[model samples]
Target chain A: MYASRTTQFIVGLFALLGIAALAILSFRLGKISILPTPGYVIYANFDNISGLKPGDEVDIAGVRIGKVLGASLSDNQARVAMEIDKGVQIDNDAIASILSMGIIGGKYVSIQLGGGDKTLSNGDIIRQTQSAFVLENAIGQFINNIGQSGGSKDSSSSQDSQQSQQKK
Target chain B: MQVVEFIERVGAYILDSILALGNFALFLIRSLMYAVLPPYKLRLTLRQIRIIGAESLMLIVLISTFTGMVLGLQGYHTLHLFGAEDSLGTLVGLALVRELGPVLAALMIAARAGSAMAAELGSMQASEQIDALTVMAINPVQYLVSPRMIAGVVSFPILTVIFNVIGIWAGYAVGCGLLGASGGAYFNNLAANMSRHDVALTLYKALVFGVVVMSVCCYKGYHAKRMATGVSRATTEAVVLSSVLVLAWDYFMGSILL
Candidate 1:
């Protein structure tokens, strides 16, 4: 069956509009990286990773660079596998910190780029990591310090001095 | 004697189902093979794209708008309970982009364009047009099936993207415009929480749904019995089966992609 010329014109015009919408979505909403480079995976070990899940953003200097590929437990520590974008080179000594978007926002991993000349490659692990802060633990520690100081001021002072000496 | 008859009937039914499934798989393979081969039939494909994608655009947009409004209204109440009303935009955006947009778009296409394809092909088969093409040394499957399948595959994702954009706008209109929710917070949270991965997943789901719609509807139409009633029945069955298949495929794709 042959369609009228006007009908065909309408169809062609609408089809082009639909395709244009697809292009707009892929560019603006999808943010599809046009680059064909393959992402490299790396791992970090943390003592605590509360509230963080797979697909959480991994950033460096507040700029997103990757995502959490997966999270697992190994030898009583939380191990997170990250898929970093290609061309983003992380130094071997870089630090990974569990951070939150805000006080009530979701958690993510923030990387502090290191000054070392050694760059981390695929499958390399970042050794220096900071765990998520748990409010209950801090409260408990605060209560313990208060009780200890109240019970024996002199003993608490001596303990603080000893701890400072150890740090030195 | 009765028990033996019942067993025989059951066996026949099972065998028929298996045969039908085998034919469907073969049809899908043939369509894919022919789609990539030479003699592309670009004009026919474009016409089918217009019929399938362009004709279904209004329906897709209308349904998406209502769905988005409902999501925003419901999400507003739910999030308000947790003092998270600012997240209404994020909730609606993610929900549409990641799930509802693609699924609804596919379902709409299957209902409108897919049924039309089935009916047209069915009538062609009933009236001997398919036979005439075959008699002329034309490969009916390549000319008829491949073009429609390729068009469906290419168009569904485009329709879905349009559906999602309209849906998100509708949600914003309802959430911030109708309700007293803060407009800035709604849009800001949406921008922050929505991700590229979600959009990509929507497109992937739409593509699979498109393939499912075309293959299923085309199979039903191609194999329809040579009668007017048969053509009608095939049209109904094509619409119903393609709708169900799109949903099932959506579930499977969601599981895999997630």
Candidate 2:
């Protein structure tokens, strides 16, 4: 029986406040963009993405400008669709590289902006891409080179002398 | 003969479940259609929102804060073993936003507001007030059920967003303050890793859970038998059914959405 007009008004006010709180959460905490403009999508192909997955950030000069939408295989190469925010322009020659946070960290895509007269449009493919660094491959190559050089004692001694001279 | 009896029972049970599903679908569609139709009870809807949403705010905030704090603490210790303690922020943020925030918020609402809504309706049914409304040329579904359902669907997602924000803050406090983790790293990683899509998906889950909670609870209460014990049983069933559906639907939605 709490049907008084005042009670209704008060309840309405409370509900409005709850809605305001949700808006704040969306804007401040969730970082949801309220812009109605749909962002542009571009594709980048890489030979090996390492551990890069969808939802990973796409950063340009350490600033995130886009996110990986999805990944697919095209002609034995990994194809990633990236959704970049509107008003941000990408040059046709921009390089997409899969980067790690740390030595053994999560993977993300880094975009090195290019200075080209022509600008990339929606659905444009970025041809120049660098794969993520493979730790095992680098270590294996290092060990292989060491094995190849280990048989030459004279050359190894000469290199050691040069390293000691540099230290001195 | 016993085996035949068991088969008959199983068949009957399957039929009953299918009938229940069809009835629920019809009820949901009718209620939603009423929501869009005329004679909108703005005041009643607001009152329901107050009862369903505002009343449950404190419990949501309290539970979310503690959930966030515990997640942060556990994540910090676990990630520390791999020397990736800084990633705790992203871990906590993603977990709360993606799964825990919507599921736990819905479960809480189902317990607090959903159960209460059912009990209220069940009592009203037992007292024949719903029948009285029908006698007065008013559709009980439109007047009683529609407002509650609309309020529930509107309130739940907002509550979920509040839960997520509070949980993130709680995680920040415990992980950065107590564990000596860098507050900067905690927030920075959270901001960097969590995207709008994740938040949007979370809101979608909350919306679906809200509809499920209201429909199941309201349906049970609306059709409750006209007896003292029947009303009580209806209330219990409403809570149990809605809670179980919330969890099951969460899994299905996560598999598809995520």
Candidate 3:
């Protein structure tokens, strides 16, 4: 009985130590020590944000360069705050779009920087913006459109089926 | 008849949810009370760490590496269509660290350590070992539950780390080594995409999972009545319930935390 207890105790200690060691390794890999330099926090007001939320990715053209920092509702408009890196120079006519991650992914802010030489300053608003287009919403609109054009007899579904079969 | 059956089904579902919530609430109160009035069973805690932590290491490691490689392969396949193959690290990091790390670790431990603990305790109860301990003045709760709880809490973080490490390396190996991705390019893209917040979220998952695993296993084990017939049911219940709770909590936690 005494021997069994001692063995159990020793094994437990060894296991605890192993766990701690593994935890330290994972923490190091995450590299939490590297801190980002603070950049200007500016708000983008839009009528709709779709699925966009805080911590979503922000991109310049197709390259991801920053993240959405804060989100709130103010004066009937959705206010979104973004923190872009200092290195990225935003032009005066840059457009920000609420982008869906993929065909069916999360929503994020996408920035399209134009060739204008002038740079945007702190607190300057980018007036040109577009909200995210949800696939479900698009499908709803398509169905509604199809119903309205009932007499046309487009036969779009039959054509689609025929095309699919040909491909197969 | 069909309408009545549907109503009955709905009623049963509601009652089951209510019962589960009530049981959880009662468990919380009991655990809280026990926390303040502890003899602090150090020896038992150590033993539990051995069984749950040490014994389960191999399984955790195996699961982690496989998970990482699979994530990279599938992520690459999908991301390639968009010419975003470089961001495989980002997907691996975000998915593994935030969700998979903790969930897989909990599932592995539940299958290995959790079920074993429940079965061991249940068998002892059936054989009257618990009664013998009671007669000898050894508190069964401390000898049985406390160590397992402490072990689960302590080792879960460690297991989580192992899970993440194996997964990340496996992903890098496949994505960079075999797939011919430039190591520098892959790592750079990985770093650019992942954030410190993701890692912190992963660790938080581990902590919660530890609590869930030990509580479910111990609850089933301690409450078991008939050793031969009832013990198997108890053990099965503990494993299934812990597994389900881990997944269910993942959804709720993501909604709240993310």
Candidate 4:
């Protein structure tokens, strides 16, 4: 006995869906791994890692240009090593900075490739690098400034009177 | 004295069923290894793949997407209480991968495939097709049961993987877009929580479910030639048995694996 034409339709429908599912899954994983690109890596020395890890995206002027590959420390400095795409060029005066999107956001290496005449080579060292700024401390600084501003006049007068009485 | 005799008879019936199950299991495992052996029947396998694997994808995807969205929404609310929003990605991933994906795929395939299979086999049996095959010296077991068995064995886990991956992505879309989670963070969370082993377990479950549904439908249809109305009964019983057994084994496998 033959399965109805409806059954075939249903089967075909599901097959389409399965293929779609595979496509969607692969897409979400952020790389379908078409062909591996061989790129050169450069090293930047830092005092701290600030949680920058491998596979973290690296951007130049907010455009993705490379990826962080490794972070290790030598005797005097922490080394941040990265793989830059062969297609992209980095200036010799370029700098890598560790940035946070928000208070709880993960760390990423941000490259500000300068407009220098010469480009940095594979093992070139970036002279300037910034570590991740702690959000809690920034927030604390803001609140402290607000508190000081609100009570500044009263505190100044009290200090003036106390100083005059001590002079008397 | 009568009650004692009744108890003895019921015990014997249960024992016989158990024996039948054992023999079926042994035969099933052996048949399974053969199904995987090379010099493969690419044409038949392809047809079954279309019937079994491809045809079942949509319902599985739809079911999984919704399940994931619901789980994501509910799971987010629950997890947020513990200040564990970070874990929501992993949580939804694990639920889809280990729990919902394989089980739902098996159930859907059973409904779509198992019933149709029984009906086709039953109709053939009712029309004296088995007698014709016998006269031609063809083994009905190999021709009728083996392909479906192989199809079920192969299809279930493939569907499971589809469901799991799709369901989690759907969850990610809703959770990230509608729920205002960062797409990068949500996927990173899922990638972190997901493991190769989870996929492996899902595949294993699918294989078991495949065997269960196939054997069940086959068994019912094999004996369907007993009466004039027996084919109809067998078809109905095949659907019901396959559905129940799929669910039962789902629960059983869940307990062991999860």
**Top-DockQ candidate index:** 2
Candidate 1 global lDDT: 0.82
- Which of 1 and 4 is the better model by lDDT? 1
lDDT, model 3, position B164: 82
lDDT of 4 by residue, B1-258 (tens): 999999999999999999978877765665565566654544555567667777776788788889889877887777666655655677788787777787778878877877777777787887888778888986566666677887777678668878888778787777776876556656665553454456567778778888888888777776576577887788788878877877788788778866
lDDT of 4 by residue, A1-168 (tens): 345555556556655665555454444543333466567788887766666767676787766677777888776777888988887888877767787644454577888876678888788877767656656655665576567775776555543432211111
Pairs of residues at least 3 apart in sequence or in different chains that clash in candidate 1 = none
DockQ of all candidate complexes: 0.21, 0.29, 0.14, 0.13
Ranking by DockQ: 2, 1, 3, 4
Give the per-residue lDDT digits (tens) of candidate 1, residues A83-166. 898899999778898976545556789999878789999999998888876556656666777777556765466444322111
Residue A32 error, candidate 4, Å: 12
Error of 1 at B251 (Å): 1.1
Each candidate's B-chain TM-score, in sequence, is 0.97, 0.97, 0.88, 0.86
Clashing pairs in 2: none
Model 3 pairs whose backbones collide: none
Candidate 4, which segments miss by more than 4 Å at Cα?
Answer: A1-168, B26-42, B251-258
Better of 1 and 2 by lDDT: 2
Superposed by TM-score, candidate 4 places the C-alpha of residue B122 at a distance from the truth, in angstroms, of: 2.3
Model 1 docking tier (incorrect/acceptable/medium/high): incorrect
The root-mean-square deviation over C-alpha atoms between each candidate and the true structure, in angstroms, is 6.6, 6.8, 10.4, 9.4
Task: Report iRMS (Å) of candidate 2.
Answer: 3.0
For model 4, state the Cα shift of residue B86 in Å.
Answer: 3.7
Pairwise TM-score winner, candidates 1 and 2: 2
